[model samples]
Target: MKTFIIRSFIGIFFGGFLAVLITNLTIIFGGLEIIDGPLFVKNSIGSILCGWFFTVSPLYFEKRNLKLSQQTILHFLTVTSLYLILALTIGWIPFTIINILLTLVISIFVYTIFWVAFYLYFKNQARKLNDCLKRL
Candidate 1:
């Protein structure tokens, strides 16, 4: 319980931080400037919630009964849905077909990048562990 609380707080902090960072980046690069206070606050809160969900959703992977593929798919869907909804609500993305598709494509690309990076990292870790076991 204590661990969970700590993890949740960490997740929220990262979420809020990332939200602000991204917003600033968008303002700098995306241009069309001028974000009012209310909009910023709303977007920040939405992003924090999204981040919290992203963090805790991985707990689903701990279900050893589910195959890795199943867990990955479930996590992807859960996180993507929350992100898309928040993106739309916060007006970070407009409600047009092309915009929606583009957002999804970008999201999928980013997710794939992280997924592959983690996969390679863990695969390397497992190989190192196996090598150590063999030596022992």
Candidate 2:
């Protein structure tokens, strides 16, 4: 519980940071004006919650006895659904079919990149551990 709380805090901070960073970047590159204070705050809070869930949702994999593929599918679906709902509600993405489809495609791409990176990293770690055990 303590660890989870700590992780959640980290996620919140990360989310907030990303929200600000992305907003600033968009304003800079896209020539968009800064939004109103209340709207900005709401969007920031939404991003923070999104980040919190994205961080903690993986804890489900720890407790479940499902296969790796099954766990991945479930996690992806759950996280993606949460993201879409939160994004639409917070006005991060407009509630249009085209916008939703585009957001979904981008989300899948980002998730795939992360999944591949983590998979390779863990596989390498496992190999190194196996080698150490063989020497013992």
Candidate 3:
């Protein structure tokens, strides 16, 4: 799909930009040196893929004629699990219970907020369309 590809490219671009920014910020704030290593390349690829995944996964539920609550639950379950897996694999989060739990909580909260915002935005658009149609 053209829309999917275009969105994926945009997502990866911004995600990579943020990844570089955050890496530099950590080097500055955390007093860490930038390492030009294979891991860096790996992380760069992982970050791009993660961004693409997040952009597309939620739309799986969005394309269906599901209730808002259903979409929220499905998106949370799918996105959070994938996010945790991707993050842990990329060494973004340590493989420990505390880190895992925190990642899970934070991922859920963030995606929930995202879903709610989009849901409300589309609902408002629908309302405006309906109002227009009534005058036809």
Candidate 4:
């Protein structure tokens, strides 16, 4: 739990940094003016909240004895749904049908890659451990 909180803080810090950078670019290119300073503050808070939400949501559904695939799917769905809802609510993304489909596909692809990488890594470690035990 301590590690989770620490990592969440780190993620929020980085997310806030990225939010500022992106906001500046949009302001320049999109000619979007921030009429109030509170907009910037709100963006920062939103980024942090979104990051923390994604980081922590899967933990609530995690089961120790579950299959890796199940865990990965659960995490992926939780993060993707939260991200989509938040993006739509904050007007970060338009809620067009094509845009929604494209965004969901991209998110699933990215999350599957992340989870599969970890799955393969842990599977290899377990295999090695089992082989070692057989030699004992």
Choose the strongest candidate by lDDT.
2
- Residue 122 of candidate 4: its Cα lDDT? 83
lDDT of candidate model 1 versus the reference? 0.86
RMSD over all Cα atoms, model 2? 2.6
Decide which is better by TM-score, 2 or 3: 2
How do the predictions measure up, each by TM-score? 0.82, 0.82, 0.74, 0.70
Instruction: Candidate 4: give the clashing pairs.
Output: none
What lDDT would each prediction earn against the true structure? 0.86, 0.89, 0.80, 0.79
**Superior candidate under lDDT, 1 versus 3:** 1
The digit string of per-residue lDDT tens for model 4 on 1-136 reads 8868876887788778778888888889988876457777777777987878776766744578877667777777778888888888777779899889999989878877877787799899999999999999
RMSD of each: 3.0, 2.6, 2.9, 3.8
Candidate 1 wrongly placed segments (more than 4 Å): 1-4, 19-35
lDDT of 2 by residue, 17-132 (tens): 99899889878999887667897789889989988998888876675578878888888998999989998988888999999999999989998999899899999999999999
Which residue pairs clash in candidate 3?
A: none
Q: For candidate 3, lDDT tens digit of each residue in 11-63?
A: 79977987788778878999977676787777878888878877876676646
Cand. 4 TM to true fold:
0.70
What stretches of model 4 exceed 4 Å from their correct place?
A: 1-8, 20-36, 58-62, 131-136
Q: Weakest 10 consecutive residues, lDDT, candidate 1?
A: 1-10
| Collision pairs in model 1 | none
